[model samples]
Every structure is written in structure tokens, then in C-alpha cells.
Target chain A: MKKFLSALGGVILLASSSYAVNKENTGCGLGYMIFKEQEGLVYELLAVTTNGTFGNQTFGITFGTLECKKPEKIANRKLEIFVAENMDELAQDIARGNGIYLETLADLMNIPEEERPQFFSKLQKNFDKIFSSENVTSADIIDAIVSL
Target chain B: MVLLHFKDGKSLIDDPSFFLSPEGKKNPYKELQATIRAINRNPYLRCKFPARAFFIEKFLKINLPKVKCPELDKFLEEIKGEKISLIFADYYINSPASMFGHTFLRIYDREKNVYSFIVNYAAQVNDTNALIYAFKGLFGFYKGYYYISPYYQKIKEYVGIEGRDLWEYELKVDREMLLLLKLHLWELKDKYSHYYFFHKNCSSEILYLLGILKPNNSPHVRTPWVIPIDTIRAVLDKNLVRKINYYPSLLTQLRYLSKHLKDDDVEKVINWAFDKSELPKNGSAFLYEFAAQYVKFLYYSKDIDRRKYIKKYLYALKLRSKGGKINYSIKPEGYPHVSHRSQRFSITYGFNKVTQYMDVSYRPAYHDLLDPPQGYKKNGEIVFSEISLRFLPKLHRFTIQDWKILRIISLEPMYSFYRPISWKVDFGFHEFLNDRGEKRKFLSITSGFGFSIGEKITSFSLGEIKVMHNFDGEMPIAVGLRIGLLKQGKIFSFISSISSGKYLKEFNEKYFFDYSLRFAFHINRSLSVRFKTNYQLVGNKASFEPSVSALIYF
Candidate 1:
């Protein structure tokens, strides 16, 4: 009985060692988000890079370390655009919007609660430049929110 | 037991002080001072006293012995300017081992104030022990003189010193000590004079130590036994004259100076010694030995410039005998920008609309079965315009190395259709009939390339331009290219192309360009799913067709 237990322990040790070796090697994490509003599916844009952005008027998001399965209320995931008249202008707008969105994310994540009011006010001014349309999809909103 | 030959036809132990120290308390320093004082105090001691005393003592001791002496004054005059040769009285010429063991000797020439120690044969003794004894003697004889050796510690040990002052040490020797040291010299002479040249099988350290303990006083002045002039002549001949190259070493010089040397052929041995060039970390020990021997050889060769030889030898010693170690080589360079030599395989389909259609040309009242079959119906008038479909599978195997240099060649086999798949009577059959009712099998041979469309996630490729000659009635020429996009797991790839060519016999030429988009999801190494879509433009027509393919990567 002791011999059997010894053999079983040896096997378990070998298996655990192999598992630890495998756990050390993991590639970059990529997540997909589906953006569906009242209308049909628009264009799906992948959020390859991200941070956070300000919203129009008094509304804005506070997206913390965003994940797809349990997305934060602030901003996360890819954005879809429905009423873009041209693809070239839309690509340019999204690229510019993502930059500010990521900055806002870094500010909110790092700033103290007392400084949040000032941070949000500054964020609002930045968002006014890119928020040309009101009918923005969730993917678009997430892009704009995290990009700043 | 002293038999002295007086200068004036008499025998005497003329210089008694030369036999023993004047202050004979078994101490060398006191005796040295007393002997010097005796010489300084007596003004006549240099010439008259020694000559007169030697004649009187010889007359008394030998009782008018029959042995005749040359006139002492004339003998003295003749030998005055000459170097005094040392004799080894202790050595037995017949006994090889004894001659070798006690080979050290003292030699001195007073007139020239030149002092040197000479050893004839020193090819035997304990290696390490002999060196220590040599250092001890050197320290004893040359009082307060600096002596250095790479093997100084070993010498000290041989001399039985636990620890010694390295920076400063005392060396003081008197007459008796010098006399005792001269015994080794006499042995060297006895050993060399009889042609019983020293054997060389002894350890190298012993020979080196022998050289070190060489005495630097002349025996002719201090002792009765002076080296015979015959022996001197022999030494000069054996050691100084060289057949080709002169090796500077007292021991080698002595060996070469031997009149009846047992072995005269030393070329091979010398060459062997020259070849041992391994740079052992402690290689200085060997170099020091070589330097010591070479210096002595230079000393004996009166004409040879000693300093120049020493400088050259030292330089040679510093050079490494052979390359020490090896290093890794550099990597190869200059690769090509495009790898046109990779083996590839692709299958593509082309679809397009044409001007000739049955709906536009057909208006038949009653069709006769016997009439030549015009496949399309347009107002019942027989009408035919150019329309073609091509399906090509091209495989290219190529190789490339440098960017500007390429040797790429490929083979592509293709199958073409002039009509749509719906119009074919037997789309899947061993043999099919064409518009002329001739049996046709669908396949052609061609060559092309595949290019990537976009990002790694998805790819589209168009193969290179290809020319095909149909094997039917007119041997119609068909040109084709393939396009494909493949994504296997995380990898995405694409290929697309277009080609046009004509057969020599047929005036009508067929052109085909197929663009395919393939997204292959590679599950693992061996399996992948390929989603493919192809758009073909033939002449002025275009069509969009999609296909699915599974790929296996080995």
C-alpha cells in the first residue's frame, strides 16, 4: 500500500510540474464585444487599443480595467457605426476619438475622488470635439469612452 | 701530502695561504680578511718571496728529484697574460657517475680580473636538490650580491632555508670556502680532459642547478692542479666551433667541445627541442633554463656578441608557440527580399456573364431536333458569342536566397469550362461532351503565385498569370490566375492573380482573372478550416462565386 501511494505521489508531482511550465506561456488577451442597439447591426470595429473617453453634455462613462464577459459601466468593447455616410471619414474620426478616450481612462483610473469633478469637466470639453452625431452605437460609445 | 714544483729548480708549497685560510677558524670571512692583509703587508710577496720559498721547499721536500723544472721566471712570464684554466682534482675520469655528480668547479683569471665558474659534465644529479645547493653556494661565495632566479624558492629550499629575505641577502666566502668549491671544478676538468664526456640522460633540473653553482675563481693561482693546455684546446674546439647553428649553453658547449664525444649527431635532438612550443602557463621556467644555457655558451664563444644574442632569445621566448584557442565563425549574409521559391498549391474558379444569351436572341416557332444545336435560345435565331469559364488548380514550387537573385520555376495544371456549371450536361462524370459533342475531360497545366490580401486574421491572394492550350479541335488558348485567402487558427494568408493568352491556331482568345478571399481557422498543426470566395472577371463580364475548403498543414 505504501508503494502504491509513493507511485501515485510521483505521478502527481510530474503532472503538476508540466502544468506549471504550460501556465507561464500565454499570448496577448483579445476580447470581442457585440454592439446591438434599437437598429440592425452596423459596422463592427475592433478595439485593438483603448483607454477611456468623455461623453456629450452631462453624460460620460468611467470605464475601469475593461473585460468583455463582465464589461464596466464606463467604457469597453468594440463600437459599431450605423449612419456613417462615408467609410474614409468614419475611419479617421474613430482613430482620433480613440486617442482621447484612452487618456480619460488613465485620468479617471489614477485621479483621486476629490479631483474627479475637475477631471470630468475637462473630459467633457474634449468630447465635444468628436461627438458630431447623437445616434452612436455601443461600440462607438465604448470606442469614444475608452479612447480619450 | 703536498708536492710543490718550485720556479727555480726546487719544489715547495710556495703559497701556503693558498692551501688554507690565513685565519683558519673554519670561518670564511675572517680567513678572507687575513689573506688580504697578508698580501697587503708584504711588499715582496708578489714576486721574490714566492719564487725563493718555492725553490727552497722543493729542494728540501723532493731531495734533488730527477724531475727537471723549466726556469721559473721564464714560465711565469709566458703564462702571465693567459687565462688560468681550472682543474677538477676530486673527479675520477674513469668513473662516469662520479664525474657527472661532482661536476661544479671554480675558475678565476686574476690578471684580467675576469672571474667565471666552469663545469664540464653535469648530466646527473637530483634535479630539485641540486638547484637549492647551487643557490646556497652562490649566496655563500658572492657576499651581499643580488642573485635572482625564477626558481628561487626551490633553490632556497635545496639550501635548507625555511624562509629568506628576498630583497636583500648576504653572500660572504673566504679562501678555504673558495678552495672547497674549487674541488667541484677539478672534477669537471678531470671528467672532460680524459674524453669521458658527460652522459645527457640525467634530469634537466640537475644540469641547470650545476650551471648555477659554477665557481668564479681561478684554480691556477689558488691550487697546484691547473687544467692542462691540451684540455683547454679540446674545450675550445668542442664548444666554440659549430657546424651550422651555435646554441648558447655551458652544458651544450661542453658537449660540443668534447674531442671523443660519444654522439656527434645532435641536429635531430636540437630540432626536437626547438619544436616544443606549447605555452604552458608556467612556461617561464623552461625559458629561464634556456637563457641560462645560452648565456654560458655565449660566454665561451669569445667572438660572439653576447648582448645581441640575449635580446634575440628573450624576444623569441615571449612569442606564443602556437595559436591558443579558436573562436566561432561569423554568420552568412545577404538574403532576398521576396521568397519566390516556396512550394505552393491553389485551386480557383472563374465565372462571368457574356453578351450571347438565349433570352435575347431566341424566338422559335417550332424547333427541329435535326438542326445544329445552338444551346442558347434567343428569338430562335442561331447565335454564338464569346463566353468562357475557367477553373484552374495551380501548384508552384520555388526556391530563393538573395534578394536580387532568383531561380523560380513552377508547374500549374488547370481545368476550364466554356459554359456555366448549370449548362454542362454532365458536371461530374468520367467524360463529358462539349458544344461540338466531342468527349472532353476537364484539366490543364499552368503556373502562378499567391499574395496576401490584408492583415494576419484574414487573407486574399491572386496567383500569377498562366497560359493554357486546350487539347480540342481548335486548340483554344485559355489564360487563368487564382486568388485565395486562407486563415488557419491565428494565421491568415491570401493569393490573387489574372492571366490572358492565345493559341496559335485559334483567332479567339480567352482571358480569366479570379480573386479569392480565404479565412482559414487553423485549429492545430494538422487541421484547418478555409472559408473561400472568388470573383472572376472574363473579357468584360464579372461574377461572384464562393467555395469552402479544408486544409491540412503538416
Candidate 2:
């Protein structure tokens, strides 16, 4: 319950602040806070994350938008962006219990091409839970994938 | 003269520090020969001999035999690094020598991995006493040298032990520039230079090193003092820095973890470490992970011994494996580059008990209690040349109020894991009321040691002692004991101290109390206002003075 409240608070804080500039920032957020961690806000995030490489280099190694982010995590990030960008198409696709975008995401997640039918059926059933509204964000998508 | 010219507009090397046979200014070739001869006589100078040799050949028209170090050559081959970067270790106020912070250079291998080698120029002193080191540093009594060590060694020292962050900037230099840099570094191999705390220190020396490659591009600070941040900015202004990275200190990382961790969960980990008999169950993965990292940090910082902590470290790891995978990555807040500059100038008009006066003040050096907190270490300040001038309108009296030579304050906060003592030292000249009720100049030294709670918005209680002396012995030395409270907030920082002491030689008891409040609300990044009021109790008489001032920064 405490975790739930903190997550709700974080959602409100992020929504209110300039941190809303980037939707890709996930992972820690309120989840880590409830888990005994403080996630840096987006504005404060860059300040704390990377150091004086000044402008040219980044920490560890760069993997697109995330540093040292693994391939599977990248797929999850892509899954979130794809769904948010095409919520209406995804809604229609899930209503029929199948879609091309879902198929592409599944491929990225390394789901077998043959299992697309059953996968879409399960996703379609969980669509409302996955994204309840226009306010539903990428973090919710990542949570759905890890839990699903 | 030629050697001096090559050294730059004005050489940082003081004459007494030089050991060459023929002085540098008299004859350039002879200076090169002496340097080469010294290099031949000593193996200690081997690492730096090559660059000096190349420099002499290029500028002085002297073709000296190339210095060789097969050992270093093979080591360089092993590293295979093509790029170099400048590193700045944040100020460690506990040690006065590092109050302005420290800067060094690093060589990155072709892999460009974080792990690299560090080249540092610092005074060679084995003194463990902070006071002695500070005294020597103030006088330029110690010799400075360049030494290379592994990057992790620096991290272990600065980050873990001293609790300071390290920021690194990669310079955009071509292969030719890189070669010139290497050659120039060798010139100073066995040479010693006077290390001035404000002017010729580590950061300034780094500027000289860069000047060797791109002399025109190095934006030299006109001031006598060169702070590390100024050097970083100078490099940026010259377009010398290509990239930047920040390596957070151990304390920062721990705080990052602690902010997210629950109080009980963190307590369990601490209890488990202290009470070795039993390991706590029902621990989450995040707690275990934090425990492991925290333990490792403790071990590296030498707060714990590996022999004793090994079992605990391994236990935390095992617990973490069971806690399952979790992402604990944290993003930081805003860039430090947005903070205000160091120098501050203020002008104010006010009415004292006697008359109305306008006061102007300038602080040339650094952080003071009333200064903004951004881009500066919390509770750390070094102030120099804090001069105040006052002009009375009714009496037509224009006099110097006070001139503070130097003041150093370290307010290291006490945390759950660490307890650092807070202390301060102040020395300067000020005008005080004499027995005749006239303003007189006197030299005073004030030193205090006490405990402080909170920072930025903190309330601190401290005991202090001060001594005042008049040169001609008209008034005997006065000593006093006092206590004070300081509560600093975003717009207002107030301090009040009351004390009672006697002039033993003068045969009198003098008491003092004053309250200072500064309001900084009407301000942006570059400007602010200080509305100050002071209530002072001298013997049986009390006086109240209020002042309003506008402060501007460039």
C-alpha cells in the first residue's frame, strides 16, 4: 500500500514537472523508491547520471537512448513507444485479438512467429489492464511485459 | 630570456625552486643542457626526459640525444590508448590544500574504458599533518612534481577515502597535438616549480600543459587566483573540451541508494554488518544489493578490513542473488554548470545608531556562508580578500570597514554512517571601537570547532574563541568565548553568536553578541539582494544596525 501511494505520488510529480519532456525514462521511478531507492527526476537525472565526458562520451557504453541497456530491455522500450504512438490501431488490433504491430513487437521480444495467434489473444484480453487510458505510459507497458 | 619567453608571459616557476646550472633566463641552450645533464644523472627523471629533449631540439636549435625508457614504451604499447582526458577532483575541504579542488590528466586506451592511467602534478610532501601541509602550501615551500598512477588508485583515494567526486573532460586534440603534449610533459620530468596555492597549483599547471599545444586557445584567467572550475570553464571557452563525464562520489551513490531504501530495511543491513552472529532474512534484492555495494565501499575506504568483512560481503552477495533481479539505476538532477560564478560584488545603503552610510564590498576568492549553494560543496567555504568600504554622508568620513585576509570553514555533516567534525579558521584586519569611542584598526584571529546539523537549510550550534590584537600595545590582547546558531535557507541565512571574555592585560571584561540576516529573494542566477541587520552587545551598551544591498556577479 505504501509502495502504491508512493508510485501514485511519483506519477503526479512526474506529470506536473518538466520531467514529462521525455517518456522514455523508466526503470527506477517510484518502483525503486518503494523498493528503497530514490529515482532522479529527468532534469536531475542527466545531472547525476553522466559526468564530465563534457559532451562527447557517455557512461560505460552507449546503446541508443540508454547506456549499457541490454537488447531485451531495448525491445521492451520499443514495445512501449510503439503502443503509445499507435494506441488506436493497437486498440482495434486487440479488439480483433490480432495485429501487425503486436506481431512486430513479439518478434523483437523473440516470441516465436508461430505463437503470434495465442500471444495476441492473451494481449487482447489484457489490453484494458495494459493501457487503461490515454494517460497510460511506457512504464505501464514495461510492467505488463515483465509480469505477463 | 628566450627560455622565460617560452615559459609564457610570466613564468610560474619561482627562481629559488630551480636547480639548473645556468639560470633559464640567461641562456636558453644552457638551461636545456643543464636539464639534460640532470636527466642523465638521475633515473628518477627518466619518464619526463623525452618531452624536454624534444622541446629543446625544436625551439633552442639544440639537437640532444633522445632519452629512452624501454620499460615505459612497452607499458604504453600494452595500454594502446589513443586519447587523453582532463580530470577534476572536487574540493576536499577537510584538507586545506585541496580547498580549491584538484585536476589531473588521464590517458584512455583504444577501448576508451573508464579504467585508465592518471598523470598528476602536485607538491611532493610526506606530511600527514593538515596544518603543516597548509602552511607549506601557503608559502610555496614544497616542490611540485608530475607522477602517473592508475585511475582506480585516484578513485580509491578521492572518491572512497576523501569522499569527493571526480569529473573528467576529454579534449579534442589531433595526433600531432597529442605528440606535442607528450613531448612537453617530459620537459618537466625532474624539474621542480614553486607551487602557489592560488596561482601555480594543479589546475593552473594543467592550463600550462594545454598551452604547450594550443597556446592561443588557453584562456588565461587575469586574476591572481585560478579556481578549478574556472580552468574547466576556460577550457570550454577555448573549445578544448570535447566531452564530459561525472563520476559520483561514494557518499552520493550511497545517498542515491538510501533515498530509495526504507528505514527498517537499511537498518537490517547495518545490524547484520555489526552483529555477525546472524544474517537477516526476508531481505529484498535491492537491500541485498545495496548492502553488498555499501560493504565493498566501506572496505575500499578502509573503514573496514577485508579479512573481517569478507564473510559479510559474501553473505550480502548471496542474499542479493536470492532477491532476484532489480534495476537500481538513478538519474541525477541538473548540470552544475548553471551555478553562479565565484567572485561577488555588493553595494548597500543603511543607517546605524550614529549616521547613514553606504557600504561596498568585494570578495575576490571563494565560497562564504551567504553565497549560493549551487555548484559548490555543501557546508564548505574558503573566503579571501573580503574587503568592505564605508562612506558616511553626515560626517563626510570615508573609511575601510574591514579586510578579511582569509577564512576557511568546513561544515562536514554527521550522517548515520559517517561523522565528520566541522571546524573554521578566520584571520583578518577590522575596525573596532576604542576606549576613546573612535574606530581603530586591529588584527584579529578567530578559530572555532563545533558540531553542525543540516545544510543549505540547517541549524547549527557552535562554540567559538576569538583574539584581537593592537600593534602599538595601546590596548592589550582580548580573548573571548562565545556560542552561535546558524540557520540557512533558500532566501535567508541567519547567524547569531553571543560571547563574554576579558582583556587579561587591559583589566576589563568585554561582552559581544551580533545577529546577521541576509535576504536573497530578489535574485536570479546573476543577481541578488542582501538585507542585513545586526544587534551587537558591547559591555553594557547594545546597538542595532540594518543594511540593504544589491549583489551582482559576472
Candidate 3:
């Protein structure tokens, strides 16, 4: 029993190290999440007019910050950002059963090209299941896709 | 010297304090010596100005010094820039400042393509008042600074929100060149120059950054104004670009995806977006998809409220998910590099019923409605500082025909799914025939708002108000209606308009009718032949004029 427990702890250690690697490599990790949520009307307007941010505060994707702890969660975090950022187009692409955003999403999920058609069809057929409610967030849709 | 951006024997750096020596701003030799001495005294200056340090070591063939800059090292390591691309965001016509488009740099890491960062040099603008913004931008009132942000942020702002397409030109740059670029970007951090809208703008600054790598091949702004696309042409002319990629906007993608949908299907999609009807059960994925895109466009254009937009969009998506995948692709045309030159010069010889004349005209900037439509917004016109002179050969005298300071026309065609207002404004001085049928020069300001319909051949009707002041001390205000048909094509294009107005002149109301027709045959990208005619009936007098002209765009 002790040997089995030791083996389990070693597996956990290996998993955690992999998670740390994922955190470091995903260069634009948590900064996007933080910056996007706090973006106000004036900042957006400034971004539109000047193609530059207002004031001096740097926002969006800084050097190094790892808020995500687990490898799976880090992947989910990225998928969530992509979905949320491209929510409207992704929905249309899914409904139409094809689009660049859909292709990109398939790429993000590591869905091979041979499997993408089936996957897109599956999503289209189960659209109601994925987008179960009007208030469905990117996280919820991602969860639906995973479950499917 | 290239890194310092010395032009005409003077440094481009507007700030005096950036120079280490007293005369460093004006004298490159003094600046180079001072930079060397400063690096010798304090090795950290090499880190502060690594680009300059690289240049100094390379040119003088001597190693001055070395210093451990943990911060600089950390920055370089974190960026891991392996490649550089010049990104051009297509023009956003709604904003006066961005009408010419925008350009920036994308520094790409070897493996982290998604995490690539963009370096943008733009005027740090805080004022929302457009007139004030224009005044400041034109006269170098705003200070331009460089800011680095994630690539996705810009993609979201330009492509998703503003519906502006992006063209990526992967530059032929190596690792060493990338290092020089990063170092120069570091040097420019928190530094600023007085931003001039015309010459010392974003495109020019980006070109200066590129000049560090290929100093001799780098293009310079010879014209008084630096157009964004012209900068792209300059770079392309030197064969600096290796590959080109297009990222279409959401609207563009939608247009391409729905191109094959039937008329009834389009109507249904529109109906679904307005919540007037439910989507068909087990509808084709394309239908549902198009419906969702339509709703999203409405939301993005602010035609629909947020609450309605969200509800309708999600519903359509949910319905669309019940169908099979449909295949479609978006291939956009008319890239900026292929567009005709912005400045134009033309000389024409023509004859009316009265006499023959030679006309010489020059436009300093931008497209007119009759200009070649390639790489420009269709049915849209922005002409600035255009002047024409007429020489009557029989009379042997030159006269100012017209001097148009600014004229803007946006004729967006209306559809059942989309309805945008068409508007135009003209501020200019033109020679007009008075009631006595004699030429009288007048300064006129005319503005109109209306609706347009159709594609390829568009028809529009506008309610216009014209205020004119002639040299004879007569100021007349006219309320009129103008209708026109415009056909814009690659090889052939034409526009014919007729206007009728009631003018309040000398405490009396008089009706005036004016008609104009113009046809242009494009010989090539740069040359075109045009036939133009005008007829005017004021009070009981009428005059007609016809002319033929050849235009060369450069």
C-alpha cells in the first residue's frame, strides 16, 4: 500500500511539472483575461481612433504571469478566451457548419482535419445541447463540447 | 546615423534631452562621438541604446564596452522575436484620422504565433472632439508614442469591431535584423515625437524603424504627405516583403459566406434577425449561420440593442447547430498595393459650343467618385486640395476654374437587411454661370443626406442645402434635391446626376436646374480617359459645356 501511494505521488509530481511548463509557454496567459474585462468605453474609443491605448497603463499580454495552475485548465482557459472573443462569429460558423473561426477552434482543440467535418456536424446537430440557454457563456459551451 | 534617423543633416528626434552632447541633436558626428564616450564612461548606456551600440561597433570596427543589463536581457528573452511582419489595417472611413489606413509591426516568436506582440506608433490622443483632433493632428499638436500589445487585441479592435480588414506583409528580415528592431523599439519606449498627420505619421515612423536594417533600400517620404498604402508600396518596391496574407473582417466573411444564398433565404434570415419569424426546423446550417451573422452585424453596427442582439444571436446559433456543415471560403480582392496612386495630375483639351480650352488639374490627395475603384471603397469619395486651371486658347488667358479644398461623399447602398444613410459635403470655389449666362466665381459649401440603392449600378436621391457667396457680393442659400446613378467598374465607370433647387436671391425665390454626366474609361491602373458634360438652367438663361480629359494618377 505504501509503494502504491508513493507511485501516486510521483504521478502527481509529473503532472504538476507539465502544468508549470504549460503556464510558462502560454506567453499571453492571464493578462488578456484581466485587460479585456476591465476595458471601458473611453479606452475602446481611444483604441478605435489612435490604434493605441489611452493613458500610460500597459494592458493585454505582459511578459510573465501564470494564474492558471493545471495544464488542462490552462488549455481550457485559452479555448475560453478564443470562444469569448469570437463568440458571435463562432456561433455563426457553427450554425453554418463551417468557417475560419470554426477551423481555428478545431485547431485549438487539436481536432485533426479528417475529424473536423464530423466534429462540426456533431456540434451543429447538438447546437441546442451546446448552447442550452441564452445566457450560455464560453465556459459552458466549452464544457458542452467536452462532454459531447 | 540611420538608427538616429538623421535626415537633411538633422536628427528626427524632437526631444532635445535624448541627445548626450549639447549639439547632438543637429550634428550626427557629435552625437556619434558623444554616444561612444557615454558608453565608454558608463557601459550601461550600451544597454540603454543597444541599437546605437550595435551601429557604433559595426561602423568603427572596435568594441567599446560591454555591460550586463539584466532588464534588457530579460526583455529580449521574453520577447523571443524570430520574425517581423508589417501589418496594414485597411482604412476606416468613419474616422477622419484613420481614413488613409494604419500600419504597425508584429514581432513573432518562433513557437508562440498566437502570443505574438504588435508594436504600434500612434498619436496619444485624449480629446474626443473631432475638429480639435484634426487641428491637433494636422499641426503636430499631439505627441506620437510607441506601444506594444498582444496581436489579438489589435485583431479584435480592427477586424471584429471596426470591420476593417488586415493585410499582413511578412518582411524579409533575419535574426540579426530582428534584434536590431527590438533594441530600437526598446530605445523608443516612452519616447515621443510631435505627430504630424501628413508627413511625420505612423507609416513614416515605421519606415524609419525599418530603415535601421536596410538603410539604403528603405524608402523616404518625398511628398509633403505620407499615405499609409504608399508606404506599403515603397516597402514592396524594394522587394522587402516575402509573403502576403489577408485576414478578412467579420462583415466581409459574412458577405462571402452568404453569397450563394437565395433571395428568399436572405429574406428569411433578415426576418429571423428582426424576431419577426422563427427559423425553419432543421434549417440548412448555412441559413442559420447567415442569420446569426446578420444579427451580430446589426449588434455591431448598433442597429439593434444589446439585449435583443444577444438573445437573437444565441437563438440563431442554437438553431444553426442542428444542421450539417456547409462549405464556403472568403477570398478578398483589391489589395492596397495594387490600388492606383493617391495623387493625380491631368491635362485636357476640349471644346463647348462657345470656344476651345485647355484644362490643367491637380489633386493632392485621395479618390473621387470617378477615380478607379480598385483598392478604394466603392461609391465613396474623399477629395482634398484639388485645383483646376483653364486656359482659353482663343483668349490666351489662364483662369482659376475650381479650387476644391475638401469634398467627401459616402454613398452606401441600402438593402433589406442593412440600411445606411448616404451623405456628402463639398466646400469649394467654382466658376458658375450666373442668371446673365456669364462666368462668376463663387465660394460654395454644399451638404446633402439621402439614401442609395443597388449594386454595380447604384441610384441615389439626396436632399441638399447649398450656401454660395459670389465675388459680386451676392450670398444665396438654396434648398434642393439631387438624384444620380453611378456605375463603378474596373475598366469603365460613369455617374450622371440632376439637381433642382429653389434659391433665395435678392428677396425673391428662383428655381435652378443643373445636370452633369461623366464617363471614364480606364486605360490602365494609372491612366484613364474621361468625357464630362454639364448643363445649367437658371431663371430664363441656360448654358451647356462638354469636355474630354485624360487623367494620370501618380
Off by over 4 Å in 1: A1-148, B1-441, B448-474, B478-490, B498-507, B552-554
Rank candidates, lDDT, best first.
3, 2, 1
Q: For model 2, what is the alpha-carbon lDDT of residue B375?
A: 70
Return the top candidate by DockQ: 3
Model 3: per-residue Cα lDDT over B1-554, one tens digit each:
77777888888778776678899878988988899889999998887898889877876786888888766675676456677888899877666777779999887743224445677778877775565676799999988877776576677667866778998888887677778878887777667789999888989988888887676677655587888888888889889998887888867866775776777788877877777877677667667667777876776565676668778777777766655545555677788888889999999887766788999999988898888899887788889889999999888999988999878788879876767788877778877666776667777777788999998799999998767776567776678999999999999999999999888663145688999999999999899999999998877778888889999999
Kindly indicate the candidate among 2 and 3 with the higher TM-score: 3
Candidate 2: where are CA atoms >4 Å away? A1-148, B1-5, B8-72, B78-80, B110-114, B129-131, B276-279, B293-306, B321-325, B328-336, B395-397, B431-442, B472-507, B510-512
- Candidate 3, residue B357: CA error in Å? 2.1
TM-score of each: 0.17, 0.68, 0.84
Q: What is the lDDT of residue A61 in candidate 2?
A: 16
- Give the winner by TM-score: 1 or 3: 3
- Across A11-125, the per-residue lDDT of candidate 1 in tens digits comes to 2232121101112111111111111110111100101111112221111111111211222344322221111111111222232222222333333245564764454444434
Give me the candidate number with maximum lDDT. 3
Comparing 1 with 3 on DockQ, the higher-scoring candidate is 3
CA error at residue B81 for candidate 3, angstroms: 4.1
Clash pairs (backbone) in predicted model 3: A124-B321
Off by over 4 Å in 3: A1-72, A75-148, B68-70, B77-81, B109-115, B322-324, B351-355, B506-508
Error of 2 at B524 (Å): 3.3
